[model samples]
Target: MVQHVWSVNELGEWLAAVRIDPAIFDLRPDYCAGLMVVAGISSGPSDTDSDQWLQAADSCDIDLDDVHLEHWRDAYRSFGAKPNRTRPSADALSRRAEKNGLPRINKITDTYNAISVLQRIPIGVENLDAFVGPARLVRADGTEQFDTTNDGLGVAEHPEPGEPVWRDDTGVTCRRWNWRQTPRTAITDTTANALFIVDALGPDAHQRAAVAIDTLRTALATGTPSATRYIDTAD
Candidate 1:
């Protein structure tokens, strides 16, 4: 079950030898092992806060089927999603992404809901200007186009008139996922900095998610500890 699909970029001389906040050089404390996830993926009007992510996915159990409930009802009929399912609680994904305008949570979305409540898997974080470049999570071929929190405008994630996506770019700053962005490309309250990404798939979660993203790119690649080149696409 080496379920494959891979991608990762940055480290362009360590993201141009930034300054700080690569989560303080990957916040290593033995470089984490399992679970510590926190994920918030509200769509316009906060995708009506799907019970604050279904009680953070039942405080950790992430059980959802029917092809992830048909990708949350096809992301609520392709951009207009609110009640983000797996629900009955987070106040039902936050009263359905707050009637379509739930922008307020920060820190790269609370550090991706604290790593999706600590690694239940299926992680997500967005907003590199809501994307158009640096986006290629790969897998989606139904004619991409999404983003129209009712005409505020933006669309594409399944518009296979040409086919191919799973995208999440930043090349030209945001393309479409409908509306899970727009704090001028999100991660606001002055997002000091971020780019922490992880997915860890197949073969025992791809050698422990490639040693947990090379122990977070070698404890943030500037102090010590080395060895990283992800994009292995675990087969």
Candidate 2:
């Protein structure tokens, strides 16, 4: 399998160019368990690369006028978080967001939804397959296990401590489940499309996820100047 690392600049550039206008599409977010994966090309079935998706809100291109940065603040008001939980992990932060109805959004909005959230459902898409398979939600037991980080170039496997990971049946890896992707599986300049979803851990999740995915697909198809496909995670 080929390993790649997408540097912050590279990822940001992709987000900037992502088709958002002339389309009624919205970004969806959901996270569950300990997992995250990439959204595009894999050379083969055994090929799994460290996949990481950065929040579009963090990017300058995302519009925050209607929606503030903290969209999930109200979602967590009813649900209680750990008292001492300052700087909640991606898993914790996303779980709170899920309780609240995720709004229709742009690239940033759609990017992080595939993983994290209370339901723990990380969705992944490839250019071909409906949904990612041969996928496994496992974390590195210790620092000794790690995928490469995208420094804008390419990366190799290295030792990582306490770094949780989502790996495919193959050796490709990413870090912190849905939070960050290692360089190895990181999306790069070559990526044309992606398979994305958040890990889910709830009962009503499928229905909710389907609504968001379907809405996004319709919106995207209608809005984009070019044609593309969107698949529901539950499918």
Which structure among the candidates has the greatest TM-score?
Answer: 2
Q: Tens-digit lDDT track for model 1 on 134-228?
A: 33432234444443244565543333222112344322112212223323334444332334444333335445555544433332232221113
- Candidate lDDT scores, in order, read 0.32, 0.34
For residues 80-194, write the lDDT of model 2, one tens digit per residue. 3221342223334344444443333323233434332322334433321211233344324453344454656555564243333455544434444344454444433344344
lDDT of 1: 0.32
RMSD of 1: 17.8
